[model samples]
Target: MHDRPAPRPQAPPARPPAVRRHNLGLLLGALRAAPSSRATLAAATGLTRGTVAGLLDPLVAAGVLAEGEPDRSRVGRPGTPLVFAGSGPVVLAVSVEVDGVDALVTGLDGQVVHRSRRRRDHRGLDPDAVFGRAARTAANLAARTGRTVAGAGIAVPGPVRGSDGAAVLLRAPNLPRLDGCRPAEHAGALGEVPLLVGNEASLGALAHLGQADDFVYVSADVGIGGGIVVDGRVLPGARGVAGEIGHVVIERAGRLCGCGGTGCVEVYAGLPALLGDAGAADVAALRTAARAGDPAATGALARAGAALGTALTSVLHVVDVGTVVLGGSYAELGTWLVPAVHAELVRRGVATGPDVAVLVSPHGRAATVTGTARAVADRVLGEPDLLLAG
Candidate 1:
């Protein structure tokens, strides 16, 4: 018999590339909220009138907005008024869990649209596996919204190494698996669009900065972390690690830290450190019990607060920010922590001046996710991409 002919391989079916269509709500909102005219947008976005027209006409035809009449009174060419069509673009945002693979989806304007939480065997899970779950979650969310997803931001639990859009570096001891992962590596699964990652605390600070002018944002979670902003810019340190006050050692030689140092503030103030021998879900639950007068919980928060206060006392002396924002789950116990932090400031040879204000972060859990979205918007829009998404 003749030798069997080799089977021919079939070509893969061609799939259309995801067209870059932003939410109509987002575009209309930008036009209405913007202080200037179409010329200003052209100058800001660097896209030609044709591009704007291409983007705007569909929105107008969809009854999302109506084009306003032009005015010829100005010395130069007439200016057309861009008004809102009422409907807007929807954005899906996610706050990726460090302990669990939980994520939250929200609109571009910072509204909670959907939420999901999943338990994973993270023991041997690598970076690719982590991002795979996130990308799939986002795609499902985008499909459900029936609207274009402008972008997605990820709130990671560590420091982002470089300003040139690199992966985040997990500095927390418990998060050893995420040591040097990059966002660029995981963008494919998240849709070949813009993917942004930022420090959890830094993003939380950005969310708080949307309201406050200047403040030090402090977060006490699986690990303690924070971010500093002056006027409206994240103050990244020379080495890309600016607000890592958690690792500052308050009790020298007291307890070992995950970063291989002994007695860092995290050793005393982190949730894991505070709930020694007690199986607690997180610091939030611990703080709640403490407020209910649970002796062990109260004692744990008191000790952690005092250590945090000691750390803040030093930060206050150096930064002297207008306000100190306490966020994260533990922030519910601000009443107990503030006084101790104030006392430590006094003991540190710094005067309790009248200028400093201690306030809880009003934005709460949504900060990090929002901040990461802001970073992605900055990449897409040719703007300064400041602390706020708007």
Candidate 2:
């Protein structure tokens, strides 16, 4: 009868790959949050001990994790600590700013193993040159560390589109040469390593995920950029350009912006705008002037702060995130900027019981670079299978 349909080879058991992936993610997340013994991982992940052991076997064999000596300090039977394998896998992080490119190699535990920075004037910066330098630096670092580079993340001072493997730099008005630069195409030195390109501010915000779950990260540099975190995740938006706060029009017919917008916040709140010709050659000088009560510097900062506050008030109302972290140059100017932002928030923010907190980033100027590395580390940790594949 119709060749008996070859006994219809009994369909394989319904083993959903997603469930396995979710369990793996849970166990890995527990370990990353804090090194834990198999028992602890099982308890934390709500997976049975056998399941935890089963999952750990492949990870340990793949060098993604390691078991340490039994902890004799425990009350009951001692348990061996599970930790990320130090020599297992690493990620290459590249931060491309207006004036420099920083390459960092970071471990899964968020430790920076090696780093190199190349400084240059970005007026007519060459994308190929920057990519070449970053790739060389990554290659050298990988060679020295002897750790497989699982992935790479590039933090650009502009909007990036698409995934890590094929990122496109949409626009960097400050560094016009980087426009349309797709870093993935130039990463020959990184071999077959996965690549990710993201906005510097967004990555900076990602770096601070350990601090709070919901907050707005404002990075004021040559131009202002922002990263919004809501519900414990960075909001990348539909176009991955959700945090272009600099372009928020604060003035109806204000100063012209490089993005062809008038009265944009960048025109007033950016470092250059705050500096103007106020006799301050750099951020330090600008800070000194503001600290010394120089009218031009302080007044400029006050105006910028007010403008920033106005924009942030609108942002806070929409996002409703209570915390605002001033990063990059704003971190340096927090003394003068926070108060203005606070005042405006108090005046304009929703009547939610006074919970707003604005603070300077302790990560300092390296926040972007550190965040880039951390982002890569996070990706690898979230998907340890990548290490196995590598």
The candidate that achieves the highest lDDT relative to the unseen native structure: 2
**Candidate 2 residue runs with Cα over 4 Å from true position:** 1-15, 277-279, 351-353
> In model 1, what are the clashing residue pairs, if there are any?
25-88, 25-89, 26-89, 64-85, 65-85, 91-108, 167-182
lDDT of each: 0.62, 0.79
Instruction: Please give the RMSD to the true structure for each candidate, in Å.
Output: 13.8, 7.1
Put down candidate 1 lDDT per residue, 239-259, tens digits, no spaces.
Answer: 647898888878786788777
Worst 10 residues of 2 by lDDT: 1-10
Candidate 1 residue spans exceeding 4 A from truth: 1-92, 101-121, 163-165, 168-172, 277-289, 292-300, 346-354, 362-364, 378-390
Best by TM-score: 2
